[model samples]
Target: MTITEYIQQRRMALAEQLLMTTQLEIKEVAIAVGYTSHSRFSSLF
Candidate 1:
């Protein structure tokens, strides 16, 4: 995979972990994964 795809994969994985293990809001999780736009993060997730 391209570097960009790899990074996105990693971020999405981390986002999934956070969602499963923590009570953070979706927006907060998105920001933690380097996404500024909630809609974009949601779309990817």
Candidate 2:
């Protein structure tokens, strides 16, 4: 897959893991997943 698709898959995996394992806020999760904006992360995750 291309870089965008790879990043997207990683974002999704991280989103699920974060949501399941921690109480971190969405924005924090976005940053942890290498994104600067929650809205952009939302679209990808």
Candidate 3:
């Protein structure tokens, strides 16, 4: 995979973990995973 693709995968994986293990909201998880736009994160997810 390209570097950008790899990074996005890793970030999404971490976001999944956070969503499963914590009470954080989607927007918070998105931000925590380095996405500034919740809409973009939602689309990616």
Candidate 4:
């Protein structure tokens, strides 16, 4: 895959891990994973 795709995959994976392993809110998790917009993160998640 392209580098951009790889990064996006990694970000999504980390987001999933944060969601599963922590009690952080969705917005917090999104920021933790480098996303500033919760709606965009939700779309990916």
lDDT, each prediction: 0.98, 0.87, 0.99, 0.94
- Give me the runs in candidate 1 sitting further than 4 Å from their true place: none
- Where does model 2 exceed 4 Å of error? none
Task: Give candidate 3 regions above 4 Å deviation.
Answer: none
Better of 1 and 3 by TM-score: 3
Best by TM-score: 3
TM-scores of the candidates in the order shown: 0.97, 0.78, 0.98, 0.93
Per-residue alpha-carbon lDDT of candidate 2 for residues 1-45, written as tens digits (9 for 90 to 100): 999888789778978899789999998898888889999988866
Point out the higher-scoring one by TM-score: 1 or 2.
Answer: 1
Q: For residues 1-45, write the lDDT of model 4, one tens digit per residue.
A: 999889999999999999999999999999999999999999987
Q: Give the alpha carbon lDDT tens digit for every residue of 1-45 in model 3.
A: 999999999999999999999999999999999999999999999
In model 4, where do residues sit more than 4 Å from their true spots? none
Best candidate, lDDT-wise? 3
Q: Residue 8 of candidate 1: its Cα lDDT?
A: 98
Give the alpha carbon lDDT tens digit for every residue of 1-45 in model 1: 999999999999999999999999999999999999989999999
